[model samples]
Target: MNIAVVTDSTASLPHELRTEHGIVVVPLHLVVDGQEQVEGDDVGTDWVVDALRRKVDISTSRPAPVSFLRAYEQAAKGGADAIISVHLSAAMSGTADSARSAALESPVPVHVVDSRTIGMAVGFAAVSASRDAAAGRDVDDVLERLERRLDASSVRLLVHSLERLRRGGRIGGAAALLGSALAVKPVLHVQDGQVEPLERVRTASKAIARLQALTVENHDNLPEWAGGVDIAVQHVDAGERAQGLARTLADALSTKVETTRLSATVASHVGLGTIGVAMVPRIAD
Candidate 1:
């Protein structure tokens, strides 16, 4: 079967890579200044980060089901016999549900995958699935590949504060870390589709160190597929820091790293000055 891969904007896959892999991206909605805007390519990260710094009240909405329908239709028109619709974690947003609703009405067979993680964590799976499809793999094989990615991948976040998370009501499993000393920096990761506390450090520097250590440890612990991995360093209003972190990770793993700026939808919840890494420890078997 000719399978197609689709993902939401929050995956934050770079345009070049998305195009190269032929992954279809559906954008989520961002409400800014009383207007609805699509996140990702439409609203530039630079402007969103700057607006957040200026205290703009930016909010996000899950992509409407119609958006997914259009994306699915486009993929079908392109001659796809089936579609693997991957999206951000269900615990994080309703984007996956929206995709599922569209899947039911899609012309071709649609398999909705709740990535259970966001950013490059989801991007990694989508790209892998796309590669599998391009190689003439069937839907079942592509789905199995995504399952392995979900099992082997991890994402760590160095959030600026818990205040934004709490305010946004997206704290999920990290709620326990709240009401602590303001100076403490919380390192978070996705656990079973919810943000959970990974570690808590006394300062931002310590948090950065902890993140770096975690990346190195995870990379070293990978199985045979270690040689082929996806590592993404992402930040909001901290591009220089992310670039530096990416360089350190590349050196530690002896592999190249990808860096991306978080979209406004993500920035609205994670807050500013957040830096993190998402990695697929190894290629799927």
Candidate 2:
């Protein structure tokens, strides 16, 4: 059976990686100053990042059903007998729900899984699903393994500022209050797909160190994604810092990590200078 991979845009995957992997990305919407823009339509990460850098007002919305429907139809037309869709945590966004809704009427079977994490944590599972499906694994078996690996993955975020989060009311006023009084850096983690305040530090350096420590501890001194046992660093316009932190994780985990900046949709909420680490485990599909 031929299977295709589907994921929402919140994963922040690069253009070349998406193309090379033959993965279909369903984009979410972005609203800036009350203007509606669909992901990959009115704007992409680059344009959204530019708007964010200029301090334009911004917000996010669920992807229109049409986009998901269109993507699903395309995958079926491209000889996909079934689709294995891995997506960002349902807690953070309605994208997964949107995908599921549109998939009900698909010509081919679509199995949607809420990856329960974002960035490379989810990306790892998505790509792995793609690989396993291409290798002719049963859809149920592939989905089961992806679920297991996703459960074993861990995500860490070092947010430079909490103003955006506070303004959006995603967090309590405590973060904003502390920021106003004195700068406080917090290490954020995904606890059951919800952003939970893991630890609060005073500097970015300390936060990076903390994340590195977590990766080493959880990974047992090595990554488990079957993708070469590695860690990945994603930042928002924080390439230099991201590189430094990636080097730290690399040494601690004894593996190399990709050093790439995050998408604007992610950066807009986390704000610039945010650094994230994704640690995933291995399981046969």
Each candidate's number of clashing pairs is 0, 2
Candidates' TM-scores?
Answer: 0.95, 0.90
**Tens-digit lDDT track for model 1 on 1-285?**
888899988888889989998899998877766777777675857767777777767778898999999999999999989999998889889999999999889999899998888888998889889988888888898798778878888999999787777877889878898867375899999889888898889988889889999988888788765447889999998888899899988998889899997766777788889998998855644
> lDDT tens digits, residues 101-152, model 2?
8888888998989987887777777787887887779899788878877877
lDDT of each: 0.85, 0.77
Name the best candidate (by TM-score): 1
Give the Cα error of residue 76 in candidate 1, in Å: 0.8
Clashing pairs in 1: none
